[model samples]
Target: MAKISVLSPFLVLFMVLMSSAPVTGQDGSRRQMVPAMFIFGDSLIDNGNNNNIPSFAKANYLPYGIDFNGGPTGRFSNGYTMVDEIAGLLGLPLIPAYNEASVNQVFHGANYASAAAGILDATGRNFVGRIPFNQQIRNFENTLNQIKGNLGAENAATVISRCMFFVGMGSNDYLNNYLMPNYATRFQYNGPQYADLLTQTYSQQLTRLYNLGARKFVIAGLGQMGCIPSILAQSASGGCSKEVNLLVKPFNENVKNMVNNLNANLPGARFIFFDSSRMFQDILQNGRSYGFSVVNRGCCGIGRNRGQITCLPYQMPCPDRNQYVFWDAFHPTAAVNVLMGRIAFSGNPDFVYPVNIKQLAEL
Candidate 1:
């Protein structure tokens, strides 16, 4: 089976959107006229933050960032991920990982995401070297304070206010934390309880951000975790686990409700939800549309569907990566990340929200 890269098609679509007509920013500025971008989430948006942590989730190694920097830069994908696309759209340089000590702080913003981070403070602790969601918030605050100290309070406020904040987390909370037997039993939380916890924690985080002058938010919801090659590989029949899908449904629904409630509570605040459910379903329904020969087989792995624990040179590597939707057991390919960024930063009104990320930055 020949692997076909899907980036050009999606890239063409995005270019068409940008070319057809221009969308004005909230401040009446043209698109790509933003000052900066602030990122917070997991490996999907992490650059090299986890590399310094000495964790299993770190991607600063061979075969990870080989396509871009010719070395692993702590990004889980072969090249830029969704966060980089968002930054590019905003006219800001790609946001550097906070752990990238070599990166100068003069740029737009920094990434505070850890690979296995989640909304809960203690989630993903046992899976990989995980940063708790609370810790991420603390880091953000510390970074903001540092910026304020250097740039002065008014300037810091203005820059932070204009900057767009991107969050790509929550999947690990459910998959790695809640689903784990010991934690689930320890917390005595079933599906609904877990959803409540997620909503509560998310609301708290959003409130904290709001207080910190984060009015415009781009919230990337959980994609089809059940449809990932990892869960599919677990099935002897090579099918997605119905149980996991069932669990994801309530979590997504509660998340939608939480977003709605938060919007109602805070006037003049705009929040958009990107439906990763439909995104993954679209890929599965028409694998050819994405140029994937085997949608269920990961791009990196050995025999069958085993890439989580063993994905290296000795194992098998697909000739073309963009064709596949997933790069490993738990993450999307670089091409898919680009597609997700287009959707996240500038999708149709219904899919995105009151406005896209480019417009939000203008606010």
Candidate 2:
């Protein structure tokens, strides 16, 4: 996924008003002013930070970027993810990966999305080589310091205030840490107990972001992990894993409530929840609607059909890539990701906010 900082439409209008007065352009070249953007999240919005990390989830391999730059760029897709699409709509450059130090100064935003990262700092401890959520924030602060030195505090404030904050994580926390290992033994709590804990932690982290000048929030909820190709294959013939799905329900519901509560608390805070479960359902309901033949079949690998591993070297790439909704077991294809981005920014009520990403950007 491409990392990005989304801008709400209202902010654009306000910026237009603020810049209505005459201002000289650099090099005598007139240009529409652009605000700086910042992004934070996991693999779904990651852009190669994990390439620097030793993780099994790394996308710096063959066939991953076959559609984009002719080679894998560490993004877990054949093309751009939601982050890239959102950034494109916002007219921002492709968000640079946090680990990619070379282009730090050129891009408007840096992606702190490490693969397998989560809401809480300790979601996936097994993936120690990867950057954690708290560390990502620390890196963000570091970047902001550099940006502040370059643009000054006042201009930096304008940049930070006007930029959209995209956070798409928390699913891994539920799937990898809490559920798979059995919360009762690992965390010594039932599913609901663990979910509440996760939600509280998520709310705190989000609050921290809000306090740090992030106002426009695009929060993506957990999808149907149980209905995913990986999970389906795991429970094949045995049927869908209702137990895990039940465990996640409260977390997703609480996430919605938490966003609402945050909106009520913060003055300019605009929280838009992307119910990924429904979006996935829509794809499964009518796969052809989004250009997919098998909603359950992945575009890569063999054992992945049995929920064994990821889209790795030994996997079989589908003949018609565009016809598949899933690129692998756990992630959506680049096409579906683009579609999701469109729904998010376009003010599509079915996907995000009360409308789409475009409308939410204006909010």
Candidate 3:
């Protein structure tokens, strides 16, 4: 005799709704993998923090967010930044910029990223006004207080511990500091010595977050700065600048070593270093494989390689934004941002070492 189990009417409806929900995994399990995604970085993931700042690094105008739902929301890309894609992939809502976030909004997460920001406070002084990494950390401390007031200390602490802290800085330190002809950073320290100094400061900045209850970190290494349209345009041959690329290599190496040391020394501290340089190099070396027709030129800038100057207001970008890797002289297009997001989320060990964001979130 065979026994048959029939579901109740309410049970049947529940099962149907659960099956139709968008939060289900491939194995049909329902989950919200992460509590939140607290982001801090430079223009690469700055949603709109730079808008209020009186800085030339602002990007809250047309052509910036042409591909985003709420157009021109101050993202440096054509649409969503890497964090936006990563948040969506995590089944979380888009994180709001720290300047614009309400007390209630802090539950989902907050973005402290700022255009022209760097790991060092003095890194982006040319911008006139920008939230440096130290200032951004202070902003997060304020957010933490708000969260504590909203959810009470214990619950807020739990949220903070569970949240993934993403950091993608240092590029501006090179572009706007070390590389700037007038800046004294170049004369003060050469490549390796500068890299060492940056790493030391960065290590302390990260420790600040760790002390504040951030247990999981996703640290993005500096990408190949030499291959950006701005650098490429500097050369008559329009070739990638080997010298500039060599300059950043030691920095990236030091960053990885710092991560390893942090993980070993800090109890319960877990880190996943995203090898952005390798990922960008891969795309530049094999644009065809990534559905990119233009890798060395900006889609909306002016002059040679479309990168002599940044994309101006009312500027007409390339017809096919997906075909271009860069949106402006220095930032990536939305398509490229999305690709990087996916790679950081679930790419191989080559891109995300030790573990990917997905694995870190699960942890």
Candidate 4:
């Protein structure tokens, strides 16, 4: 997807139409669009999976879920994540985390996201105990077994075959591994080469998912990691890092290319790449138009740019979270999540490649 300094007139109109459209089931009974939706990735999509784990990324505390119903259910944001909105857009209930999955909910889907996780197993080693992409896949496998036991083998296979697999990986590979001074990845591979390594690993990981019964894939591309609050705080001028942004370009491009390849290689499988990078670029450029007043800093946190680890426990967030682009140091606010979810659910090709999530679900 190309970068746009300003949203087009048609896009604005289209967005209005989409937002106004009533979301209902095929029978107008409010049934879910997909049988299930299994989410995978890092903190961006993580709801409560990291809470029990012995990792430093837990968020089931006050000020974290200030906007959420339960008031911080381990989500990194103050309210819903993008996937939460997407779940509603798909007419499905909020998907539960692997740890929170019950027998009945196993038929719906499960979220396996953990903070600091990445495509590479070692990407978030410093975080310790984070569930990497591969481990998340294994978690899904366990859920699949439970599904098979509950729904029977044949019924489970059919149900799983039609389910949506929303994978948003690779962000932490840059933030937690390659960019971290403690890691030796940067010394081993240059930008493009590292991207190739990650993509190759990503391709196989996704293929494993296909073999395990994922057919409808929403592959979320990496966003502008360099523009996050943490990166900004590290810069002398408090600006976005040019080198960090340049490093992940190949990874994003490679993911798009990999999507095309996967579509051709895998039979009965459909894959669409969500251009998260372009979404961030659009938000950065047209934030005011989107009703965002603060974009460069976190709504709540303590430090140079509130880019420290997550916000301090019990810390008071901004009075109005809807006006900020970022909720914490590394995640978007609930409002931004809602916006991205809506657009990706039914936006044009500029944000979602080939076809959007709606079209993919219809397939």
- The number of the candidate with the highest TM-score is 4
**Candidates sorted by TM-score, best first:** 4, 3, 1, 2
Which TM-score value belongs to model 1? 0.87
lDDT of 2 by residue, 33-75 (tens): 2354567777777779988667766888876776765478888
Q: Quantify all predictions' global Cα lDDT against the true fold.
A: 0.71, 0.70, 0.86, 0.86
Q: Candidate 4: misplaced stretches above 4 Å?
A: 1-14, 17-29
lDDT of 4 at 99: 89
lDDT of 4 by residue, 28-119 (tens): 34558899899999999899999888998788888988988778888888888989888887888888999898988867789999998999
Clashes of 1: 0
Tell me the TM-score of model 3.
Answer: 0.91
Q: After superposition, which runs of candidate 2 have C-alpha atoms over 4 Å from their true positions?
A: 1-34, 101-107, 182-187, 304-306, 314-316
RMSD of each: 4.9, 8.2, 10.4, 2.8
In the range 1-363, model 3's lDDT, one tens digit per residue, is: 112245433233334533543331122233567888899999999999989878998888888888888789889888879888788777778899999998777888999999888888888888889999999999999999888987899998887888899999899999989999879999999999999999999999999999999999999999889999899899888889999999999999999999999999999999989999988887777676457888889999998888889989878889899999989999999888877887787776767888999899989
* Steric collisions counted per model: 0, 18, 0, 1
In candidate 1, stretches whose alpha carbon ends up further than 4 angstroms from where it belongs are: 1-32, 101-107, 185-187, 308-310, 313-316
User: 1-363, model 1: which lDDT tens digit per residue?
Assistant: 233465434344555655643232122243456566678888777788777675777777767775664567888877778887666666666677776633245346778888888888777777557776678778788778877877898888777776677776788887777777767533687778778878888888888987887767778777778878778777888877778887877777777777788788987667777767766666665567556666787787655575445357434457688788888787778877777776666666555655667666666
